[model samples]
Target chain A: MRELLERKLVFVTGKGGVGKSTIAASLALLAAQQGKRTLVGEIDAKGNLADFFETGPTAFKERELAPNLWGMSMDTEESLKEYLSLQLKIPLLAKVGVLARTFDFVANAAPGVKEILTVGKFLWEVREGHYDLVVVDAVASGHITGQLAAPQAIQELVQVGMVRDQTDWMIEILGDHDQTGAVIVAAPEEMPVNETLELAARLREETVVELAAVVANRVLPELFGRGEEEVFEALAADDRTPSPADLLGAAVGGPVRPILDGAQLAVTLRRTRGVHLARLRDELPTGTPLLYVPYLFQRSHGARATRQVAEHLAEELGY
Target chain B: MAARQRTASAGSVEQLLAAKEIVIHCGSGGVGKTTTAAAVAAMAAVHLGGKVLVLTVDPAKRLANALGLEAFGNVETQVPRQAFLDAGAEPRGELWAAMLDTKESWDDLVRRHAPDAGTRDAILANPLYKNITGRFVQSHDYIAMERLYEIHASGRFDLIVVDTPPTRNAIDFLEAPERMADFFSSRLLRWLTVPARSRVLSMASKPFYSVADRILGSKFLEDIAEFFLLFQTMYKGFVIRAEAVARTLADHRTTFVVVSTLESAPVREAEFFIDALDDRGLHLGAVVLNKVLPPWFLDEGTTATAKAMVADAVSLAKVLPEELGSPDQVGRVLREVGESFLNFQVVANREAEMRAELSAAPEVVASVPYFDHDITDLAGLLQLGEQIWR
Candidate 1:
């Protein structure tokens, strides 16, 4: 985490529903705790991350969400306007109403043009060095690869000029081992874990971006020991009806069988989660560090849960 | 098939599969939307006796694995009848699946709409076109919509199930055709077509050109000009296709099914998307809440009794570990189990609340519990379909 904070930019990506936004928010919070000025960039227009802090929708402009943390939701249109002005050096184009039309044309003419602008916004911020740490809560799994690859793709196709120069700089920042790193966030589930491994392999092969670590989110705690399994089985299999002695210390009325069944269910879940976590550890690149975040059973994923995860992250990463 | 009576609640998957020609699965990512789509398509083809084509617009190859097939290309491949039979489902109709090749679809569009072969090849060979079409942001969604229109027009299958990319991307998928139409007809596109006018304007804006040329190079600018020049004659074709797609999407037989999990975020997104569909006047058929934790069997009173019994066991275990041979360990395990059960109850209550909230608005809500294993095979999908349709 300290190394990640020292870098100018860090990207958190994973399969959707693996809590990327929450993890990204936590990383940003962790960075802020270390006295680094951090900007968390979310590409989601719906502003899911803003909800984590109970902040209103994150605007395109950065807002101070915490002491040293700022948040902004990337608007591709705004980014495109900025990119146009920067690349074309035509300040007039920024003011003209035609910019929106041109955006539409570019967006329609080229499928990935808007994506480049969005990614370029983060790279531009990283280059400016305003914030000590920049965290991009990138779009879901495969799209993250596309987002990271956009500048390079444009450079490859364009061959020369402002786009190429801009992408070259972006690539350098991303490719520099010490400057930028990508961390994958995933749940302790088969698909998310599989997708994370796939993304890691592709990230290694396709881009020069450094793979920082894998944050396995929602991992369950192992409660049963080897010796205890037999005891639990004996207890669970003892289906004999509870007598008055069993009910003597009871707090309420009804069958104890449901409780035993429920316990068995818990044991099943714990073992299942354990299996998935082991698989995740085994399948991820050997040297890549894996951090575990306990499954949050809270009613709502609010600030406290994020903070809890962040504290765990700080500890695990030795921050 | 019987004429199913329309009810206040969203109809079952069987009804939707039998009735609607187009069923689109839209949701936030990683809620098993793709798996659900594949399962529904499989169910429709194998059990319901309807020829179904499942179109995956996502870049991932998840749908193929979910349906127990090898990776499929842009062209539809029939799922071997033997696989369905092996899964114990006798099919009267065929199951076909395909992955959308964005570039190929765009190429097909060019082939269909370009004024001539020369113009088509010119646009196709343009490095700008090749790069953008293959990697552009909404190109996947736009080309996906175009492909949907093309296949639906062909009448290839009785039912077409589309697994959309994800939330906002799904919105883009829904709106792509109209946006593409607007782009083709926009004044800016017209302005770009007239090379002489662009040249005159560039001459007037000499400083901008000098900087742009120095940065982007003269060849890049020339490519841009030539690309636009080549596309100038194809705008009408683009608009016509877009219009045709828009009509296809709005067709009466088409329906959108928003899939989500029991979690707060996905539920919120699902409601928002349903409202967005309402705003667009698109018909929403159902909301499939995937991976919902099943309700606890023990009622509140029974749960209290169970809790008390477990507590009694823990107390006994702690006091008599030596006599009971690891009673303390037993207590610890029971305590953890009790805690887990309580947590499960909490989550189950939350799911119920979410379902009730969604149900209050009068949408068909089908809740499927979290399967113990990943649904990556035909048998798993069939079981999932049973749960959903049941």
Candidate 2:
């Protein structure tokens, strides 16, 4: 039941700046570490998946970022080109080349075309059995619903033709809850949590994909247990004889008040975040898994940060 | 304490807001851009006298409540004067807010530019119009700019602070007006509708349509062609308005205020956006760095104290009065306190590095300290306003 990676296709999405790419990269890395042949693709052209992997830039052509883990950035034009060549079976590359030039011109004029091409490529990979798992670092939540609903939208829009014919199979794959799922990355903030809950409901009302899990990123660790907080508060209280700030300053041979203040800030941060996290848990459908990844106080995004996130994800999933 | 390298920066943000008619807040999403825009606008209404309007996009629900909006939509609503007084502000100007309703705005555009009422109804009834515009990533960007133009032309507010939609690209909205113009005049639209208008399939477009019709089907071709043909009727009107919108954005009176946190990714994006504004001759007003940590976290002497507290936790705990707690528990708290400071130090260092690496030369850079709680009301907003007022 907790096997999000077991799905042939997983879409990772969230509000922007919620570390959607980071979670997607880590999920793929974890799958690969467990010896699954994983292909992680980013839907946005200017994705930072490469930065997370600490690898060279990715393109339409897949590059192996690690053993058993491959990375690629989705380009709808390239996708349209590949899709056309496959559908057209035009051996003379020049004919298909002319059509590719008109791709953007036509795609922009027609609505659902670019979205279908992007969704179609991922479904194509899953259908072709190119990898054991396909993790897509999908667009932010504001846009993910459109991508998820594209096949159905296309089917309803385009009544006939090859595109219409392709829609049936994509819908079949997407509608199967066991095979296709969306992992929403949330950061337990007011806006992000509200957006996550809205997206969860929208996913059910709008798309065929299942809500696999909600990965809460940058979850602040609770600094004090039950009685410890009160004691810490009393120690910092001003009226006490030889105030704790003074006592600690003399004992440590310098000011330790800032350190104490830092702890207070940490506790308050966690307390405020807890309210939102609780709301998320209560509002979500019963039994929807919520994974926690602690705040990584690292220098920057890189392979190490990605690995640390992966390890925490594995622990949350009871690996 | 503020790593404000540019000694002259803070004054410029205040001055820029005071002078500019339109201050567009642009940045990557979730960097608190909406909040910053509201605070800046609030500050303007209080300190700098004018009829100020904040054109926000997708603000948090609490924010709407804070602004005293019951059910916010495309309609511009004035912030209650009572709200100003309650915030302890003796405002010399009025503050207004309007949330961008994409669907409503698109409908408004159709009504405004449709050559005839029949054409307006037909375009409104077009299914493609409803789904496609809602799905189009750039449509939101385009509508926002277009609406800004619409409001500015009406001369309603002396200052309009726009919180730009979260765009996939840096200058998406900046180029949206031209794109709308280009889209209406595009050869693709002409080609598709030319065949429909005269029912003449030319030799050149025959093969292309066959391929397109095969994938899209003949019926869809009709729907898309019909949709564009209806839109084409408004071409002259739309093109002129779009040009005017473009002019409004490019005018020196309209400035760009880039907002971001000091996280590595956001700072990088902010710098990139700043450079984009610079290259295009759009006035780069200020870069607002939000949720910045206090400098005390990075103090060298404080780090030494934290280290000492962690190293001699038991002794430090014993030295404290018994009113605090048991020696063992107090020691645990002491150790935890030291460890937490060290933990925050890592992030503080990261933020400092990110700030140091920020390469864009924005006229002003206002740093806002991280507030421990969410700002939910007008008073709360103006409180936030104080931090960036400098």
| Runs with alpha carbons beyond 4 Å of true place in candidate 2 | B1-4, B9-12
**Leading candidate by TM-score:** 2
lDDT of 1 by residue, B8-62 (tens): 5656768776778988888888887778887888888876776799888765565
**Judged by DockQ cut-offs, is candidate 1 incorrect, acceptable, medium or high?**
acceptable
Highest DockQ, which number? 2
Share of real interface contacts recovered by each model?
A: 0.53, 0.81
In order of appearance, the predictions have TM-scores of 0.90, 0.97
lDDT by residue (tens digit), candidate 2, B1-390:
344477633465678787789999999889988888999898999989889999988756677788766756689989999988987889999999989999999999999999999999999999999987787657899999999999999999999998999887767889999999998888877887876788778899888888888878888988988888998999999899999999998898999988889887777788788888888888888778888988899999999999988888998898888867899899888888899999999999988877765523765777888888988888889988888777
lDDT of 2 by residue, A1-319 (tens): 5379888999999998888989999999999998999999999766678998888899998999999999999998889889988898868778777787776667766778889899899999999999999999999999899889888988888899888999999999998988899999999799999999999999999999899999999999988877999988887677866788898898788887788888888888898999999999899888899999999877778999999999999999888
Chain B TM-score of all predictions, in order?
Answer: 0.88, 0.96
Q: lDDT tens string, model 1, A189-252?
A: 8778778888999998877788888899987666576777666565555444543224323423
List each model's interface RMSD: 4.0, 1.4
